[model samples]
Target: MAKGYKQMLAEADALVVSVTAEEMAGKLEDDSIVLVDIRDPRELEREGMIPGARHAPRGMLEFWIDPESPYHKPWFAEDKIYVFYCASGWRSLLATRVAQEMGLDAQNLRGGFSGWKKDGHPTAVKEKRRT
Candidate 1:
């Protein structure tokens, strides 16, 4: 039998550390932390993201994190606490686990962007990138 989404989420959850929106909000001013939003472009356009969060779409995450990959993002090489979030917490939980395995100090945003909005945290509209 193949592992289902639930099994994957459970495995990821057990391995990754998750921080609540309130806790994350307190770290907004912390320079040592890096907020990473791992959602689709459409989702970001429809719903704004956390202020100061860097957009790293989920599909390209592995490539972006791998230093040897041509798609590697230099920021991912920085020595900072990376907090990954999606619209909901599920995607981020899995992403966090992969990041952690890749040797980054990564954590998941509990309840994700929805939770952050519900908690009244500040958000900023993402301008469409010119490719």
Candidate 2:
């Protein structure tokens, strides 16, 4: 039998710390916490994102986090707590585990963007970056 997504998610969840929307809400203004949105661009456009969250598409996350990769994002090298989220937490959970393995202090946003919105937390429209 092959390992499935459920099993993968379970393993990741066990290793990665999860923060509730309410908990993350309180840290919105904390400079040390970096909120990373790991959802796809289409998803974000269809459904706004948490205010102050940086968009880092899930497909390129590993490359972006690798310092040796040309795609590496400078912010990932910063000494900050990374809180990752997706539409419903699944993607972010796996992403967080990988990030932690890469040596960053990463965490998952419990229930992801859905939970945040359900909890009445504020969201902001993502602006298109100018070429």
Expressed as tens digits, the lDDT of each residue in 1-131 for candidate 2 is: 99999999999988999999999999999999999999988788878999999999999999999999999999999999999999899999999999999999999999999999999999998765556
Error of 1 at 97 (Å): 0.5
In model 1, what are the clashing residue pairs, if there are any? none
Candidate 2 Cα lDDT to native? 0.95
Q: Which run of 10 residues does model 1 get worst, by summed lDDT?
A: 122-131
Candidates in order have lDDT scores of 0.96, 0.95
What is the C-alpha lDDT profile of model 1 across 6-92, one tens digit per residue? 999999999989999999999998999999999999899889999999999999999999999999999999999999999989999
Q: What is the C-alpha RMSD of each candidate to the true structure, in Å?
A: 1.1, 1.4
> Clashes in each model (backbone N, CA, C under 3 Å)?
0, 0
Poorly placed runs, candidate 2 (over 4 Å): 128-131
